[model samples]
Target chain A: MEFINDLMQYEFLQKAFFTSIMVGIISGVIGSFIILRGMALMGDAISHAVLPGVAISFMLGINYFYGAVLMGVLAAVAIGVVTQHSRIKNDSSIGIVFTAFFALGIIFISKAQTATDLTQILFGNVLSVRTSDMWITLVIGGIVLLTVVLFYKELLVSSFDETMAQAYGLPTRAIHYLVMVLLTLVTVASLQTVGVVLVVAMLITPASTAYLLTNKLWIMILLSALIGAFSSVVGLYFSFVYNLSSGAVIVLVATFLFVLAFIFAPKQGVLWRSIRARKSKSAA
Target chain B: MTGTVSVKNLHVSYHGKEVVKNISFEFNSHKLIGIIGPNGAGKSTLMKAVLNLIPKDKGKISFAGDSVEQVRKNIAYVPQRSDIDWDFPITVIDTVLIGRYPKLGLFRRPKKSDKAFAYKCLKQVNMEEFADRQIAELSGGQQQRVFLARALAQEAEYFFLDEPFVGIDVASEKTIISILKKLRDSGKTVFVVHHDLTKVVSYFDELILINKQLIGAGPTQEVIKPEVMNKAYNIDFDLLNQMGVGV
Candidate 1:
């Protein structure tokens, strides 16, 4: 009740709340495709790759979104180039590129003259989210959701069977690059809420939890978005009451939901499988 | 429309190794063509190169004088079962609906007619009962049927299947071979990359033997000779006799 009153009273709280919700929804939506495509490591790479750009933007007295998105896309392209041109596998390429960018980001952050808080960028301080960041999050969120709706079929086919998709002239490579771009934009939008380090949790945990609950792609996506939004709201409330970091709290809430679903999902849960096994065994 | 495919001097390499070397063949309509070879003989590679699914180092492939791009919608490919991720979150009907994507093009949703047609294709493969089931919930034979149903939904003129008989039950193999025969009788072209040499004479009307190159291409009776089988598989006639081939 007090949180609701404060949410009504304070403009910063309103911005943070709305921004977090948008971040949650878009992360869950795009994250569904990422995990389905087996690109969860790519998602983590793009999020971490945003850090050097954020530090550079702070050094240049500019908004971090532009730099962060640019770095994210560059990192994605570099990973693609390395994997395609060399014998190195996708996971190794992602690890090598992301860690280099992360080290560069640390160097840039230490040399920054301004009093930019690295902790906030690492773990997010959503309470101090700028108004412009909120607006940017809304725009990115809208683009991600719209693209998913328009390209759901293509995404589904390409992820499920790339060879068939390519055989049917679907331009599977182009679709892959487009998804990478969307991941970059999603990483940029999520920076103000979950920050760089914990954004993958926001992207992956909710979708994985939803995966346990459903067997259809559309239903999984919808449920994942809902779970993400719910976690964000509840985490924000708890963060406010306890004076905690909003990003960490939100990630914890998402993880908590995942735990619940892991044990109790109706069909795919471990407990459900055990119960079915016992029943069959008794019948035998 | 011309219902023939011609390939001249086709070459396909993987990771700088030539898997399919200087292969060329001509396929006519209304025939169930079998691509038969030993393991690592580039049978799948040749099929993929012909379908333009993978890049060819040097090749001139024409579909009745039409380019692959011009007739892509008319082509349907069923890759090996191992290539698919069965645990993916998709329903059987939805998987079949993917075939209609080529006809629907981009930015358009599947309509009632499309759904009805997908159901019809499912029924054709006797998989309509499993339409709503998740793909992972299916048996190996059921999964292959679902894929065949998806190809049927494509309403394609040319069907390319790679190792369709591998890792499937005898019932599935019979069902799939019957479907291919039916399609061939309807004047559509069907190509199967088959590893099982015993079923070659019964399953296909024509055979294209390859050992990283074109060993022979002719009627099944002519291509299944002892010398040709020896050249393609590099094995003795005694072993071929053991595999139930009366060569």
Candidate 2:
């Protein structure tokens, strides 16, 4: 009761809760696409790659979000262009860029000797969320969610069948680039609440869990957002009570949900399939 | 009448080796042509070259008397089933809805009329029931039907399908043939890259026998001669005749 009272009274905690809800919705929706396209690792790569960009901007006294977004977009485009134009495989290209950027960020952080800022950027301190950050995340999340819904058909077709989309005279290349850009925005926005290390979990876990339960894309998006929101709230409360890292707790909760879904989901789950097979065999 | 599609002295290379040699052909809007060749014959590469999907070293392709870019909207292509990832999380209805994307322009959503058209295309392919089902849940034949439905939804006058009949069941093969026939009947020019020599005679109205260069082309019966088969398949003409695939 005391911890609950503390959570309700703290302005920073309120901001964290509100901002996480907004970021959860955005990450959940976009993350569905990322998982379906097998770009889960790519999302992780972008999140890590933005570290150097954020570090450089912070050192130069620029806004961290702006720096992160710019670098994230550049990294995504570089990966896309390099993989498409050159002989390098997609995974290798992502690995190369992400490692280089992350290493540079670590070196820069060590040089600056700003331990508190670096720790916050990497691990996140969600209790420090400001009203400005909350409002920005909300606005950006709303725009991204609306755009995704509006262009749902185009994205589905391009992702499923690129050649056919091209043959129909659809600008598949443009859509591909646009999707990468949107992913970068989502990653940068999410970093504020989930931090860089755990952003990939927020981006992938809910969607992957929803994917195991449903085949319809729209339903998957909705369900994923709900699950993400639920995890965020629960994890926030637990962190407030236990004095744990909010982002880590949230990701751990999501991963637990994912494992549960994997084992017990109706159509595709391991336990469900095993029971189904046993029943059929007994009947035979 | 649209401008002619002319390919002159085209050469296609992949990884620094020539896959398709210097070849030239012209197609207009009046015929349904079948590109017939054995595997590794570079038929797909030639088609891709015309579409600028693959780079060509020394070729000029002009469409309907216009450049490839000028008439990009006038062309439609259907890739093989193996080319797509069927496990992708999208409904059959949504897949068909993509046909309207080019016409919808960027940042614009599909309107009601566009969805209605998509439904109509699904009905045409006898796949309206599977519209809401995820693509991975569909059978191979049904998957092919959905691809055909997507192509039909494109409503483009010129259609190219690469190996449409591969791995499909008998019923699907017949359905696809009828669909192709209907497209031809409606005055849409269709080009099919087909492999099965057994059904060549009954399936295609016109034939293009290709082995690096145009071996023979005309009506099906005229193009399926001994010399053409020998040249295109590099097989004994007598063997092809014994198998009832060549004259």
Instruction: List candidate 1 stretches off by more than 4 Å.
Output: B238-247
Can you give the TM-score per candidate against the true fold?
A: 0.97, 0.93
Docking class of 2: medium
> RMSD per prediction, one decimal?
1.4, 2.4
True-structure lDDT of candidate 2: 0.81
Model 2 residue A25 lDDT score: 79
Candidate 1 residue-wise lDDT, A45-71, digit = tens: 999999899999999999888889889
lDDT of 2 by residue, A15-43 (tens): 98888887787888889988877899899
Query: What 10-residue stretch in candidate 2 chain B is worst by lDDT?
Result: B1-10
In model 2, which runs have C-alpha deviations exceeding 4 angstroms? A1-4, A282-284, B243-247
Candidate 2: tens digits of C-alpha lDDT, residues B1-247: 5634677888988878888787777766656788888888888988888788777988888876777766666666888889888766678998888777767766777789999999999998888998999888888888888888877877777788888888888887788889988987787778899878877888887887778777876788888877768888777988757887544
Who wins the DockQ comparison? Answer: 1
Best by TM-score: 1
Interface RMSD of each candidate, angstroms, one decimal: 0.8, 2.3
TM-score of 2: 0.93
